[model samples]
Target: MFDLRMWFRALQIIPRLSKDEWDRLDLVSRWLIATRAAVFVMTIVSAGIGGILAARDGHFSGLNFLACLIGLVFAHATNNLVNDLTDHLQGVDEGNYFRAQYGPQPLEHGLMSVRDVLRYTAITGAIALAAGVWLVAATGTAALGLMLAGVVFVLFYTWPLKHIGLGEPTVLLVWGPLMVGGTYLCTAGQWSWDAALIGTAYALGPTAVLFGKHTDKLPADRAKGIFTLPVLLGEPLARRCVTVMLVLQLLAVVTLVWRGALGWPLLVVLAALPLLRDTAAVFARPRPETCPPGFPKHIWPTYLVAYAFRYNRRFGLLFLLGLLIDLALR
Candidate 1:
């Protein structure tokens, strides 16, 4: 049965592909797992906001909104695939699974062919782009523009700009706040400052981890002629930078509260017990490796999940709690 086989495959991935060379299934499985999580998260955020706005305004458009959410998920998954292809083409990931690893490692192990991945990425991208077009068709210019920008940033994250060391900022702007904020706006119609701020906070925490993880490999990254912030700015400065980013995230909570963008209960951000663990990890460099995997593996995803806790248990939960309070009091 497919279920049995799927179960076996999932179990095998933990140990087998974790250390073994890349395989087609290895790449496909990782891609699917992340994509599924993303689609699930984004769908929940978009849908919850859409539902709430509908309840309040009495002008809720369900089908159009649902279609738009689907499109957002499609667009996001394709973006991840595109990142994979660009990284594969760039020599940033030189087939050595051990040296530079994050996201999908099968690429470096020669487990899957570049041509196959690129072809699949293109197919998935086309689906996502078409979905974006559908959103544009339904909502007009703003949706179209945001969708186009999202697509471009996703593809370019690992392209020419990445070669110049813009990876962290790009991820921060696009992956962090941009995607979450843009998705909220697409559904709610008109800009909500709460949506934007929450999206930014939603994005900022993860970016800290992602940036920290990337910085951990500054030495290897620099030798490869890549230009992440750590390589350009030096390790000590980058470490300080991580501290600053975390402070900025904390500050965002206060700003949200002041603006009525977040409610008092939004203090639940403290529930990020895992993030505290990450902070400890960030301050202490990883042993087997010089830098910590705290951010990429533990931190970035943790922020996103925590952000999802208050509402529908998807993405943007923390922000939604803020939004709920905003709606209730007003």
Candidate 2:
């Protein structure tokens, strides 16, 4: 009853499920769905980018790299679990809000209790903390500081950050400097501003996804008193903001390459420009009132977010691949 297929599906998208269906799922599938594992790929890519860079610089520690990767993924899983719990407690996801419509919000959907989610959060968070403690013991005070910063973001990101307009920007920072650069620091045993800067380009992808999601549910968030960036910007401006961020991602890569910070092989990411264009085109207009032809009906209400997620995966993988290629040639 491992349900390999559900595990795979849960990692690709938030699979909506009835309470009966949820009860039938294996523990792994339940964990994947509950943690919203689909987005963990972003963290993987960031960690890979950091590891590859460390290897390129002749500072890679396989053990440290592996620990960092596990730690970051668990941290992300913990954050997702906490976000759902916090929103539910705040009444932000009531009445079949946008969140419950797209995925099984364990609590919102009556699939789990408050106690169940807290249990998940505590276990997941403890694993992440163990990894961080090991990293700090091995790497010194720098790692400790970075880990603390990550904890702050993980603990409060849903409440004050998303409620205000800081959530999207916080994602960029957490994914970029905090995750990528911190991974590099742990593996390389040194800080590299260059690594952090390079990470910002990739960070933009996840940030765009958050922006798109907020935009997709702008009305609902507004009504719930969640002033996410999109809610404050208004739909049209919010959509444009996502488009701008997507373009900036490409520009960041190009700028790094032009500055000779990266080799020519990194230019391969430029191939993602067409994807950027496609995502921009989607954001240029309003979300359709209904699922368009050929669009997957299950994902209807997630128009902008779906497109942004697609683009982010493509662009992030390309960036990682390009980095690997660059490292090989050097």
Candidate 3:
């Protein structure tokens, strides 16, 4: 029987499951949990921003935009699968490491085999690659270049990039200029610096989330030789960095509005200011040594990342909403 409830639950949060619980899940539920689909909204918001900008410019293609959206989501899914595979191979997620603590590390948890993960990666990556090929055929070499860049990042992000402190910066570039700007080019039939600028602002949200996650796991990563940005920078500096990035996200939008690249309607992103303030306050303090009183127990091990994810989702949605309003006014 199909378990719609588990499907929704998996999409909402990375549900922790025992092997028996995992065995009962439907395929889609398992995939959703495995890939961390809750975060896929970030990609959707990026693509939506790009498509809306294209429509605002009077150059939108519904078909191309649809393809771009699908392609980006699948590519993200592929990246997640590869991230797990790489970390498993590296022994990074072993010994109840931070990653395996928060969610089911299908491999580390003994729920899935190496072969199982590779098969998932192959199918997901193939779909993403197929979409990219179709897009390149439709949009030409520029699109091809963007597609290749994405592939490179996907292949190497978890290994040297995440391990060497380059991971946070990579997320900024991929989510911002690459994903959002590339989506615009494919759908609008041209490049736009303005769209890229907006993307950079939006990209800060995800970057902050990654920063927070890294910060939360800094001790474990340091012990395990992961050397993520947080490990390299230390917790205090990394926490401060996340706060700054969140503030910069707001400023970037203001700059775009000031330059008239975007209209005043885009100021609607200001609605997320309260979230910014809340996230900033959390980042202002060090992560608690243990799950604080009243905090959700299942999400205990992930403190800063949870707050960052909440703020990012709010900011991303509001940014998209602002774009929609800007389009309506135009």
Number of the top-ranking candidate, with lDDT as the measure: 2
Query: Clashes in model 3: which pairs?
Result: none
RMSD (Cα, Å) of model 2: 0.9
Write the residue-wise lDDT of candidate 1 on 1-330 in tens digits.
Answer: 124454444432222344343333444455554343323453455445544544344444565566656665666666656655566676656745223343344456554567766766677677767767876676678776777777777667667666677777776666444555555555555545555556566566556555565565666777877787777988767766666666676677777767765667566554554655455354444324433355344222223222222222322465466556656765
Q: Estimate each model's TM-score.
A: 0.73, 0.98, 0.98
lDDT of 3 by residue, 1-330 (tens): 789998888778999999999998888888888899989999999999999999999999999999999999999999999999988898788888988999999999988899999999899899999989999999989899899999999999998998889999999999999988999999999999888988988999999999999999889988988888899999999999999998888888898899998888888889889888888898999889999999899997999999999999988888888889889989
* Backbone clashes in model 1: 4
Order by lDDT, highest first: 2, 3, 1
lDDT minimum window of 10 residues, candidate 1:
303-312
Poorest lDDT segment (10 consecutive residues) of candidate 2? 260-269
> 1-330, model 2: which lDDT tens digit per residue?
799999999888899898899999998899999999999999999999888989888899999999999999999999999999999998888899999888888998889999999999999999999999999999999899899999999999998999999999999999999998999999999999999988888899899999999999998998889899999989999999899888888888888999977777888888888888888888898888778999998887889999999999998888888888888888
TM-score of 2: 0.98
In order, what lDDT does every prediction score?
0.55, 0.92, 0.91
Which has the higher lDDT value, candidate number 1 or candidate number 2? Answer: 2
Q: After the best TM-score superposition of candidate 3, give how far the Cα of residue 104 lies from its true spot, in angstroms.
A: 0.4
> lDDT at 277 for candidate 3?
87
